[model samples]
Target: MNPPQNPPQDPPQDAQLQADTVWLESIRRRIRSPSQRNPDMSWENNAADLIERQLQYDGHRTWGFVIYRTTYASDADWAEFLRRLRFQMEDMFDYFNGRDILEKFALTVFEDRSLFDGASTDTIRQHFQQWSSTAYRTEQQQQQLEEGSGSGGSAGRVSIGRSPRYRFAVQVDAEALHSVVHDAPAPPELDTTKKGWVKLIDKSWYLGRSEGKSDPLEPIKGVAEEDVGWMKVPYQNVMTEYYTKCRSPNNWSLNYRRPPKVAGSPFD
Candidate 1:
């Protein structure tokens, strides 16, 4: 008679650990080279390079500015432009070990004319600082409740709490500005302004918890609620995935699965 066959067995724990290590290494490689994942247009790349260079040398500064010009024929085009900008900023922040610092970042959009006419960066900066302070307080309160000994109070509070990320401010409606395209080779009469001017500043003024802490380099999973108000339908769905599913550590691993894209989503 043939020898009795042995029953099948699960893989050894060591083998599983080795597989996980390999997967994590792959993710690290990807994070190091974001350009390979999303190739930017020539102008877009230039803009991103400018911002990255500024951060590299003057990252300690509380605020900075960049001039951006884009040609958008429709609302969809505008949305795509904003989405690309978001991704580029995220990559730059991660590259400089500013992932945690990103929470204190704020963006303000402006028309070229306003910069030369009457808009004040100081006023905008002050408002953003106030908003960031309120958000910080809210988060602290929630944390305290989560750590409380009260049974019922902390019960179903096991749910993950929300925290503020990026905040944006604009004078006019985003959709209304879709038709205002700026493709001029040179900036307008104002030497310091471009058709599209964006102010990127730190609301925390380098006084937050992330002041000296460095978070692990990783991809930004979703856009903040304040940013979603400026995005279109497809981008909104992307934000949903980021807020709901991508927040978990398990989703950061290589085995994480992305949800199906919405009908017209530009993302893969």
Candidate 2:
């Protein structure tokens, strides 16, 4: 419901696209052919495991060459890349499994650009330049993307593989939860006691009102820490059911934040 916060800003150079011809070729190969789905491809395999392995082997072989040359890391340094690659892979696997293992893997891999690290900012920018200059390098015909080059935005690297619909599930009314008395305000279930007071029930936030407080004009204790994240927007998408028909007794459970308290008023 909250507007997405802007990510921390990196320098303009960090926004550049990967310009390595070989890497580009490798990506095109995956998107276009999907090797396991094809026959007559020498490296194609049947099992998902085999297909994944082949894709990784070929993809990395091409990418490793481009990364080494573009970043100009020595052979030994590239060899050491294994440590970083393994560590990164472990982190990725911990969060998401196989499909995530495929696309998002590269974006994070290049994040700090150390495996590809070179000199000062100037040289590093130049290193990025080498990868982004597709016109100067060998450019491949993008078949699957018959739409010509993607007008891919800054988050393209990550967004390419993220969920198609909304990434986070929203709940308008979470289960009726009861907590012990502290009497600072009304429990969230008792919405009728107050006016203009709404609960933004992110799971991380507790939605109960003060134990005995009934005044909506007064600020509630559990929610109003100046230090925490507070947001005004409950739903920007008016099309969302949360905005149109968010009420209890209807029993629509999805996108549920917190229901109005079913018990006595907060001050009671």
lDDT of each residue in 1-268, candidate 2, tens digit only: 9999999975565334444555656765666334433322322222223324533432221111112222332434333433333443344333233343233222212324454243232233344444444411122213213323465422111111111111112211111011111111222222233321212222122234233354343233344322111121122111122222322223223333222322113322
Q: Which residue window of length 10 is worst by lDDT in model 2?
A: 172-181
TM-score of every prediction relative to native: 0.25, 0.21
The candidate that wins on TM-score is 1
The C-alpha local distance difference test score for the whole of candidate 2 amounts to 0.28
Q: Predicted candidate 1: what Cα RMSD to the true structure?
A: 19.2
Go through the candidates in order and give each one's C-alpha lDDT.
0.35, 0.28
Collision pairs in model 1: none
Task: Identify the runs in model 2 with alpha carbons over 4 angstroms from their true place.
Answer: 1-77, 98-118, 133-268
RMSD of each: 19.2, 26.5
